[model samples]
Target chain A: MLRVKSPQDLGAGLLFIFIGCVGLYFGKDLTYGSARAMGPGFFPIWLSWIINFMGAVCLVRSVTLEGDPIATIPIRPILWVSVGVLLFGYLIEHVRLELALLTLAVVATQSRRQTDLTQKIVAGFAILFGIAIIATRVQTFAFLKPFGDAVFGVSQWICLALFAIYALLTWGERDARQTVILSVCMSIAAVTIFVVLLGQAMPTYTADYIAPVFSKIGSIFSSIRGR
Target chain B: MDFNVFSNLMTGFVAAGTFQNIGFAMLGCMVGTLIGVLPGIGPIPTLAMLLPITFGLDPLSSLIMMAGIYYGAQYGGSTTSILVNMPGESSSVVTCIDGHQMARRGRAGSALAIAALGSFFAGCVGTIFIAGFGPPLASFAQKFNSPDYFSLMVLGLVTAVILAQGSVLKAVTVIIIGLLFGLVGTDVNSGATRYTFGISSLWDGIDFLPMVIGMFGLVEIIRNLEQESIERNPISTKLRDLWPNRQELKEASPSVLRGTALGSLLGILPGGGAVLAAFAAYTVEKKVVRNPSFAFGKGAIQGVAGPEAANNAAAQTSFIPLLTLGLPSNPIMAIMMGAMMIQGIQPGSAVMTSNPDLFWGLVASMWIGNLMLVIINLPLIGMWVKLLQVPYRLLYPAIIMFCCIGVYSSNSEPSQLLIMVFFAAFGYILMRFGCEPAPMVLGFILGPLMEENLRRSMVLSRGDPMIFMQRPISATLLALTACVVLLIVLPSFRKTREVAFQE
Candidate 1:
């Protein structure tokens, strides 16, 4: 039977109240000792009560005063972005950093679809790979390097990513053939950065069955170079 | 004893002047400028995003980098405002007014120069102010008992509520809720965990990185993405003649001086101090300047200089309360406090005596960082302006990728990502309800400390409530708090505050 003049205020009031109740309910079990011998619950309980009182005041104000209406919230952006982030998060340790990054960009683009889908896909994957390479320090092929195990510098990996980003981004007005070429260039740069620089232990890719084959291939190449 | 400031600074310079620290400081500045020039990102998210990178750094080096980022971001924000009329940071919003107008009227060079020079002068003065005042304040803080500390926090929280943007009541509730959130995790006194929901990660309390990145970083990206077309068309600025003319300089100097003085004082207060300082300086300049080459909004150099100086000065001095009293006056300082805690160092008066090198080194690095901003950013304005053309569609995904890697790499646990998702959703909901999540962070940081001090005070008083009134420091702080509360409730002050924000 209560009329809400300001939906924003009303919603905020309800949220504050709910938050207070959660605090109170969860903290109920802890002993609320006297002030002189205060227990864990003492301060929290006091704070929760104050929050509840504030919420009640907000509720009264919501009905009594004129205020702003709640603005319409766009759900697509938040949903797609969140989905993309979560996908990257869960996929990083399993699928590897590169694929996870690619998945994130692909998912995020779904929030606002455009006719330049091919370009979007290319730029998104390119820039994201650049960021991923920077985020987790690139691997140094310390064990397999031809420099008698002496590795190159770490800065080159970042430069590789940076170059890939600039190359693909500037070619946005071009056709898909160029996009593919740029993408290939970026991938080669990424692999070289990971393999040729001071290595980090970050997993770039991981598949249970294919892991043995890659390591086997690496061992064979190292053995061939050792002679 | 007063002469010790020089020796202290000498030590600070020696410690922070190392090539390693300088390199980190410059790196932080460059990264910070890149983040700040990009619209839709603020210092809070940028700081949260870059926090993981500093994990491998020495405490002093990390703090230096963080401070560099803070100042560089603020400076970069001003540049964006001058060049594009899009205020990249909140404190630079007023700058966009006359600053962009100056650009439109072909005095963009003058505007940028005045702002940069004014900010440089302000930053130097602020650093000196900290050097002069920090020790005295810390020494005085040493005299504070548990009750005094408790009262000080109460005063801080009250003032923060008053100074925060939007409704007074709502802000109060938000802070209270934050305090409650801070109470989650294990209680130091009792060794019992509260509100963890049986999760192992909750035993250590909520992780700061996930909460911050989720709330500020992720939410920001989502908000930016919501706009139909995130196209940015920056005004083409000619940076060839970057010096201000004699007349423009002469006009802006006095206003800059006034702004620096006003800001240094206001910055010591709690909550949104820099933002308020900028806003207040604009009002002061309007009243003080007798005439202008153009109208106030029509490219007045005084309008551009005063607020820019004030905000930079405020940003520097806002560290006073956090450094001396171990209280975070704003959310930004709260993050600093969190960083210090993560580094296993507690911020307080003791830091001056116990970790003199780190304290003075940090203070010295601030000056170096400011110098770096002026030197590095002036030449790089063209590069930053070009960055404005990078489409937002490409930017957001990169930002998200960076955030996820930072968060995951920091803890390397899957649950941390889940925590981020939770905070992002919570922040999004709060945004819809017109409730800010910023003040909550301040409260959360203070929560456990306040409880510990409060409980100790109660014990010292033998359960008597009047002990707070008996102590001089406590009583004075309480009195100040009462005055602030009265100011908030008063109709006249409220009207003025409303008018101030309206401009």
Candidate 2:
């Protein structure tokens, strides 16, 4: 490892010098301009020579430096991630986006939490079933559009419950409740700001639909108290 | 040239000074910060997402908000780079070297403060330069012909290659690959498809959103998952004491100055963007700094300060080439040019003659935006520092979800997601193999522009090729290019290589 610097420097510098010279040589096909004016081939041709000179300087410097000759760090994880990303380019189209993404996340992740057989099965089913339900039955949230294109009013208690359950079950963790809370609050805030405060005309929603949903939520709480 | 332009601009500010514009600027800043804080999404996509909303506002207000987002995003980019080792864009890569290290060593607060302060200073300088020098610069640019632009673009491409780390062959190859990828959309002259491979959707070429998010963001997510939790170094709770000491400040001040100058200059070049400015600044600092113990890669303070300032300065100055010459140096500026057209204001020399208020209003608004940024970032440094302490397990999912949502919202196509994922995997591999993704990114950006200019120059010269050197500006640029080549080529010129190789 200690002797690596000299070789690396020399190697990089020599390579640059070589390439720069190639550029310079090719630049000969270009016309040289006076210091005041340039010709057609002037820039590329001259730039090549400059690159070659810099590379030579770098190569010479490497000779005198004391560098380690061994690999600096393990490279396996990096390789895995890079490969995973490329695979995703092919995977997302054939498979649903949610599934492809979850799979990618699980494969690359190295978590400290322990999972038994039942947990793994349950987790897998949880991810799959959760996405399926949201994609098919959930009407309030329009995430996977072309598949589940529906407009429901707040009268649908089932949709509201589903959203709550999904949020709690998925994001709810014991150690970090703050993140979950923040996500929930922030998501709601964002929706309110975008949809209600900013008055961005929803492609689907109208004033009548929103007005009733709030009233329904209020009524649900009031009814539980025997109002 | 018009002294009363300031007063006229102040009149436009009646539109700009309204509560609505203020709200938009603040909103833009907050949103820009969030987007910039993320490791992969830069301002370009963020602006694109907000593009539809701008249609409702007056042009002055909309432009102000977008400008706020531009500068705010620059500040936000530094946050993730410093806090985590994740860089939101190629420019922030330099910041990661020192910034993440500072976090590890418990000086994350100082790094954030210095980056914010340096950016504010540069932003102020840049705003003033724009207001004072914009008209003059515009006129100077009018002198350029296709040959001049061609030569300038060549300089930019070469400079990008020279400043990039790693093997020159690899850099060049990646650059060429990017160029080729950019050419995939359509043939302008012949109206023929070159490399679409018969995919009809791809006939328009690869969408920038999916490509950028996949290559940088998703790939990063994959890499993050592979590693053990990023809790290797916990941030300090007592962040109030994190300000740089006098000595550290003294060391870093000059770097900030140098970076500002370098950024200001490079930002004017065609195809030169924040990333290039940052890299060039870092390289310059690396070369000029004396007795630097840590190598360029190992947590150098100048690495953080220089690049941060450079990016901010470059962000402001990039507007120069775009507004003056009507040349879009980057995708973001191209979008801005588009926005201008939507407003019925054409970008070119005539804009200066016709719309002095619009021009000066923008320049004045930049100064105001810089002031707002400094006020917002300084007190919020501790809050940003605390954000760094969030656990990876809790954080990674949200990051992935955001990437998914951001990508999906852009095109509403499932294919884009697939493209992003593929690029993520490919990007991860390249990272593992020690490939610098900066070259690939730069290649992708410059390739199309380079081809266009080359063709333009060729057509103008009737394929003679001598037209490039016929002009003074082009000739000078070519000479410098030659000198650069000679410097790289001459083996005997490497006598002082030892100093350069010092750790």
Candidate 3:
């Protein structure tokens, strides 16, 4: 009786049959005009019949034939990654969207393995938090005007230098260091080309729409270089 | 219907006759053949890429090039099947046995020559059918209301499932999944989102590029990756013969003729994809051919000649449903309709009367383009055969990277890459489970059409249940559908009855 061993077939067929019947019922509510002889419900009602019939055939075939044994389903990685995406969705309003997305990507990639769950989370958080700080300082200087700009600029340079050295030190152990580095480089390159060559203002992450730290830093660099 | 059509069609001939148009057709053939020879890539993306480039050209000229790519891909698929055991598309799989076996015996050259010859002959015959019969067919099409069209789509869906080589139930389920996937986007009439789950990007609906790239390009890469090796088996060194001898031709001729006829009929059916046509043709040929000395999986010359011709003929015939009814039978044709929309050309029955030049020109160009492919593919078979000699280790990485690029470029969205990765893994599991992807593809193509028709029929009938049985055409189709199901189930019923009586 097990020869027709397609569980996927059975599940899908039953689902269709159910949905088709629902569509058929919903279609019944509409008053189809006689202009075409068949009304709106005619199609779905007929389709549902076909679906039900097909489903029955499948069910019968599955019961009558000796099909291959069902195998175990893979659930962990798909679910874990889905959860990470949900978390990213939740964090987008508070954290920068790019940072949130990056964190999601990192955590999802890491969660594929069983042992690295804790370590992956710690690394993910550290990266997200670190980027958040840079964006915050960038937001601060732009909002506070001229006096705050110079102060933030000096601090950002020092912080950037420190982070670069720290990143270099950590680059040896993590394969994701490459992705992070590429991400940083690509973001900087795109921002630079857009602001300088294209003459567009960078959109700020802060509520007040303060210019991004990179733009202020670029302006400062330009003024200093002009001197 | 008017004298203007004659002038317009003549204008179409002029448009197609130019050096520029001819060059475009030739270029499309060359490009199409190369991509077709590569396993895993198909015509849609290649044609989509060419679509934008056609913006500057006359509409007829651009369409001719696209037609060239469409049929060129069909002919190109056989080349890969002949030399390597791999087929770029599901339909081409039938060609692999004899084609590669012919290659193994150092007659790869002859196998290829015959395939190309059969394809060219069928393409010519099919083109004649399209040219002479297209208008009459298009006129005859007006009597079809939405319900009848919908019923026909149901018939197509049933044909896909029953004819497919897997469990019939699985085919139905896979088709339903495809329909659900189609329903994942925005609701056109209600403006109510169906299944986007609040993702704004999905508000427009499931993108065709991602679905196609995921199911086709990604799945193939994953399957290839799972294999320990995907190298071409070694062939004999002599490899001198290039033409089919009398005995070979004698065996292949009937199969080719039979395949052409089957493909012509099946190709016109909605949801009847090229792969389905090929498989159907192979089954018919197997049933009819006496002695059929070569088993299906072994080197059978009939296997190569029939399916190749059938698939190409079917690929051409598929255009009839799309051009006449504005219904795209497959995703590739759907993309073509998108291209037509981009050009502000409506694809429905109005197109025939409104733009005879464009319509007739496109039809005529299909014949010309097929001829171009034959002339183009024959000499280049030697070049393609040399490509099979490349090592698999070198080839797999390059193929995988190309797959990644192809998936990425289809929509310029990295999300598709992710989908591809997931589907690739899923595809491997499908292969392991002995589930064929061909039926799934056919279902995917037909699902939405089936739903649309069913809805249209019910709507037209004013909620009356008996509309399907009342219409002669619809009744005939439904009865035929019932007959097919009964034919499949009757033997099982008898067997069960015997068992019950024995007890």
- Best model number under DockQ: 1
Taking the tens digit of each residue's C-alpha lDDT, what string does model 3 give over A1-227? Answer: 24546564554445556656665554565444343444433333444566677667656765665556545544444344433433343343344333433444444433333245444544555454445434444565354455433433453343344335434544664544554454455334433433333343323143123455667888999999999
lDDT of 3 by residue, B1-503 (tens): 54343454465567577787788788778767766666544555345334433444567776887788877776777777777677776667778766888777677778888888888877877766565556666776677776667666666666655444555555565555555555545544344455455566667666554455445554544444334345665343233577888888999999999989888888877666577678777777777877765665567788888988888788888888778877666656766765676467867667888887688778767777888977877877767656556543334333333343333333444345455545545444554444554444444454455656665666677667589889987788788778766754677844543332221
Error in Å for residue B24 of model 1 = 0.6
- A best-first ranking of the candidates according to their TM-score comes to 1, 3, 2
Ranking by DockQ: 1, 2, 3
lDDT of 2 by residue, B105-126 (tens): 7777778878988888888778
10 residues in a row with least lDDT, candidate 2 chain B: B494-503
Off by over 4 Å in 2: A1-227, B1-16, B35-66, B77-115, B232-263, B266-311, B325-362, B439-449, B471-473, B487-503
* The 10-residue segment with the lowest total lDDT in model 3 chain B: B393-402
Highest-scoring model, lDDT: 1
Summing lDDT over every window of 10 consecutive residues in candidate 1 chain B, give the lowest-scoring window.
Answer: B1-10
After superposing candidate 3, which stretches have Cα over 4 Å from the reference?
A1-64, A70-227, B2-12, B18-20, B39-66, B234-240, B245-255, B269-303, B327-346, B391-460, B492-503
The predicted structure with the larger lDDT, 1 or 3, is 1
Clash counts for all predictions: 4, 57, 25
